[model samples]
Target: MRSKFQQRRLFEQTLNKIIGCNLKALPTTCLIAADDFNDEASFKRLVADLLAYDCRYFMTYGLVAEVLHDKIDEVISDLELGSKGILTAAHSDEPIDEIAWFFVNATAPEEDCVQYFFGFDDKAAFNELSRAVKKEVQKLNAKFND
Candidate 1:
């Protein structure tokens, strides 16, 4: 399997195009896997930051997954939603909270197994993530570029 660096480099090569795909709002696996394939560390951090939507409850109060989805996905959603310090592009006019929710609550990318492979851990990469996300928003859409 390609290392995290390999994956990140590949993604960086086309990061703008992929982010512009709006696939997170769609179901295209091509954008998901191709862009998300990162080294173990990078993948783990990205997934962790994306969050599972409900793991905070478990982490904070020791709540069991039984009452919830009882699945690990819920945990991932929580982390994604909880992390701070990620950047938001100006074009992503949506508030940071809303964006985080999107990453956390949105349906999973079918090719997201890479996240599980290293036990996605967002905290490890929140700083870098925020910067990346913030930059994306400010980038003028190609159609509107000078």
Candidate 2:
């Protein structure tokens, strides 16, 4: 009977581990430098990085984010926060091929899992997708809790 947040968190964690299967030992917090960072969003995104991407990384510059402008502040804000790598990104030096391969290979199963829970969508569709998924997970969690 996991709570909704716990279930979503677990799903996100599971996805990161599965995606990082190719790495020898996975990365850690030393990759980032809050003291060096100056933006607020970068700070939040730094924390989000840990949650989203896990500790697994081939990064050293804390993560050279190529984030959209709106997301920029959040990334700056995440400067010192932590979690899995689901919210993380790669540094400039990291091989984009490796990341591309990671994303391509990791897509099917994780997509299936998400599709099972809440269906599919691209970025423009995510607003609806997010709402549906949250509501669904909440309903299921309520049932299990009952």
Candidate 3:
């Protein structure tokens, strides 16, 4: 198991890669947060800032597996309501709450646009990384918002 600092560093590194790769220019980056953490004013501000860049998706990552799973299920249902259910059905698996970070490029012609990053399982590390990510996001908001 990696140390808390290492885990947090991993989060920072992944975020930097996302930013450096010009994913922001593509404007498809969606910083997903669980509803438990989504109520924060700062988080809302970040989302608003990202929206200005033409990013349309704001995925809600529920803190628990069951809630996240249900949310995806509901999404699948909604998608099925339109065209064939085949596309959304791919995500019908169980909700995964163990990830530290992930990225998605919604504009891709293919559905395999999501890239997942699994952080250390240490709670302390996760908490530290979350805080670090929040701070970085807040700082980045200034650049994007302006």
lDDT of 3 by residue, 78-141 (tens): 4343242222111213233222122222322243222222122233434543554344433323
Full-model lDDT, candidate 2: 0.31
Q: Rank the candidates by TM-score, best first.
A: 3, 2, 1
Worst 10 contiguous positions by lDDT, candidate 3:
3-12
Root-mean-square deviation of each candidate, in angstroms? 16.7, 13.6, 11.8
Instruction: Give one digit per residue, the lDDT tens place, for model 2 in 1-146.
Output: 55432322112122113333222122221122111334555444434544343333322222333432224334434554333233334344445344333332332322212211111112232343234334544444421110
How does candidate 2 fare on TM-score? Answer: 0.23
Q: 94 in model 3: Cα distance from truth in Å?
A: 3.4
lDDT, model 1, position 40: 46
Question: TM-score of each candidate?
Answer: 0.19, 0.23, 0.33
Candidate 3 ranges with C-alpha deviation above 4 Å: 1-23, 64-93, 97-146
lDDT of 1 at 109: 25
Considering every candidate listed, which one attains the maximal lDDT? 3
Candidate with the larger TM-score of 2 and 3: 3
Best-fitting candidate, measured by TM-score? 3
Give me the displacement of residue 23 in model 1, in angstroms. Answer: 14
